[model samples]
Target: MLQIEKKKCFVELGKFLNQFSLEENSKNETVLHNDLFFDSFVDLIHLSQSHNGWFTPEQVYHSVQSWAKALQEENLNQWLSNYDFSKVQPKTVGLILAGNIPLVGFHDFLSVLISGHKVLVKTSSNDQHLIKFLAQYLIAVNSEIENFITFTDGKLENFDAVIATGSNNTARYFEFYFKDKPSIIRKNRNSVAVLTGEERREDLVQLGEDIFRYFGLGCRNVSKLFVPKDYDFQPFFQAIYEYKDVIFYEKYSNNYDYNKAVFLMSNFKLLDNEFLTLKEDTSYASPISSVFYEFYENIEDLRKQLENDAEQIQCVVSKNAIPKSIPFGKTQQPELWDYADNVDTLEFLLQI
Candidate 1:
């Protein structure tokens, strides 16, 4: 129902996002409403780090660039192609967003609006500014979208259905609170990488980006590694040395110092570089500045284990060693169709 005009509006917004990069904020004359929004967006990106220490300008720009590529006309068409939206009755769907990373809830926002549904958003306090600013730009591009978007501060009351993302404890609370409504409640999940000893150093180096991006705050960041028994970790430690500068960030350094001291106090053996620590653990969720690794006995056994534990994982980074796995360093670059928790968000929106 919103395929024609609204699609173009989003594409224009994409063009706007593309203009700003870490290297430079270049203005393209063709982009709509640049006079009103461009300078302000740049200011916001710089000011974001002050608002939330984890939201560095580089991370915010990376998120912006990713969304820009996803909002291309061809990408949008491809994403919406399979769904038949002929009968989508517009309803005000409420969203409870997470704030682990910058713009983490934008996908849910886009899904609801693009599927011809009104969205009532309750943004996490940690991430309150960027989404609202983006919404303003969308309204500027296409005035019709104004009625379709609303950001609420109080309890979400006037919505037909809900989608909420949070930690596992909060997920239980959401399930109880939204019991009377149709809802999708997401819980904590982590990503892991499967490594073979035969891999080149370049591969491990790329995996460092997967580990260090967004200070490993995003769910897509690889928090654990599955390695063959007796796998020499020298290559990994050597390769990830390129990311050693990550320790320069005060927040990351604080986490590293705190987590490393705690591990030392617990008498756990750690393979530590100056910046990152590798611990042998069975848990999927590792703290920031650290990655937990487990030695797998066999490929088949590892694959089966991953399948059994798929619900707790957001991504499996591998070189085709596992089915449905993404490549190293690519967990953060998900395509539009790659839904969080493997749930079809657009499908849910259309049905709602």
Candidate 2:
């Protein structure tokens, strides 16, 4: 009965969001315009800025709507059909939210809520507002959410299952404490891009948005690039230089200065402009100083390199052919179906 109710509720929520997406003050429009609505949202985030990271309100709204659509009834049903929930029922689920990116915990939150389990959330101080706002909104939508969710500022205990997201060090702590329980302990990760010689200048510019938006703070942001050995770096750099205004922000400036100092100390080479620092790393998620670019001589070698680094990457963006399972972000926006930490959250929900 609970499962049936959740499915109906989600379907209704999804429909409402579809309508919400059409409003004049829709989330995307506000982001694209960088207008008054965006300013208000930025203010809300500023409240949480004492820590390292805070989300723009546009990021919060888009993520919520996306989760509603991705975890819709039919998808949930398909995932649940193969599992037995009788054993996982009424579990107390604990979730640790990551503040490195906005709405990083939404998928886990949806999983616990739709599973009909009680949720205990430990929110990152940097991102407490959106969850608090949504908690209120959920109650408005179906008041009964109050019965299933609770926010905590301290330690939680006796939870049957845990889904925690944090740095690699923090994940170790969670593993030690919850190893005996059913858990998904997520470690730090970032995404990457594999560029073939065929990428057009327009696509490269949009790809810069993937790298520069949010000041390169999110897990979805591409920190590393894989390019064909013969591909020239100047054109790629030129395409992204148009967004140089993005680097003018004080926060980004600080990172750039700090990284630039470190680069000078280390005697590393880089080509910099107003917005980005371009360096080379064979890894994912570059620092504020620059993104890492590596050149591969052949497609087969590139594929081999990507396969080796698959465990470290959350997603891979490419203009060339990509696997069906890998998702693509349209411009700087992510659809609801993109799961963070590479977890299939809706599938986890149905089993509980």
Candidate 3:
């Protein structure tokens, strides 16, 4: 299929996704294949939590909306405009997806297909259904696309290149296993926020979205904070109070209770706000229901430290406190070009 055909298929997929939201889902008859897909997708969203306890309706809807916005013509054109597709040759690209958040690996799947390549996908068992459902929708939109997508339950084979996301341990295994194939093997990474004590209440509230979204499972979630020495925690707590209801979820509440007890038993000092805990730690990766914070005396020195540990970080959120840092709450709303681990996926696919 031509690149334009693939693009049109995804554009239609985006329109289908735009119909669903956390507040309500309204069907749009004009969308291609809506009669078959719209109602089924709604049922799938409702059933997502049963498949994976962390896939709440609200979280899944947020991811759907994010993708809907991303697949618009303007966004798609602008992202693809940067690349030259003339030299592209079709190859079967194997994708080993990560199920940390809803549809987390959709970008890779989209990248390979949109670049005029066949995709052999190994959907994480935790996220087996959603992407497969979308693949069916895409094929329905354009039958030509059917030949381009495949999913496997067993070991991946017959693919010329590969993209895999996993923890640090699995990444080591992937590096050795896929040693002969051209690949992008992603490991663990976490996001951090740098606070300068001048943030408005709204900014801090947005930061809460970065921390609490996906229940802090996504790599883009702000798991650490770098604040000035003697930074006041009261206002930050107040801003994040809006998300206090997250504690009502049974799973999150269980994590909160268990982690809090573990900390208390260890005699560790914690800043608690009834729902979330803030601890003083130098680590970037924090546990669910908590964020680790550290004191930084100078911005330059902290920048140097973050640069030194670049591979461990995914994104840095701040109000221009660090170079190229993302704004508060926008970590989860990454653009098409915001490749994970700063690796250019399109470039990799094109070259392969």
Model 2, range 1-352, lDDT digits (tens) per residue?
A: 3756655555555543443321233444411223323444444545544434434433444554565566566766765675555655577888888876656677678668766788899998777776665555556556676788889999878677788888889889999998898788888777777787677788888888778766677777788887777678777887887778766566777888898879778988876774667677665767864788887777776677677876677777886544532333442355445566557665665454
The 10-residue segment with the lowest total lDDT in model 3: 27-36
Error of 1 at 332 (Å): 0.4
Using lDDT as the measure, name the better of candidate 2 and candidate 3. 3
For model 1, residues 97-126, the per-residue Cα lDDT tens digits are: 999899999999999999888899999999
Per-model TM-score, in order, reads 0.99, 0.82, 0.99
All candidates in order of TM-score, best leading? 3, 1, 2
* lDDT per residue as tens, model 3, 1-352: 8999999999999999999999999888888988888889999999999999999999999999999999998999999999999988899999999999999999999999999999999999899999999999999999989999999999999999999999999999999999999999999999999999999999999999999999999999999999999999999999999998999999999999999999999999999998999999988888899899999999999999999999999999999999999999999999999999999999999899
lDDT value, candidate 1, whole model: 0.94
Over 4 Å off, model 3: none
Question: How far in Å is the alpha carbon of 305 misplaced in model 2?
Answer: 2.1
Compare the candidates by lDDT and give the number of the best one. 3
| Candidate 1 backbone collisions, by pair | none
Worst 10 residues of 2 by lDDT: 29-38
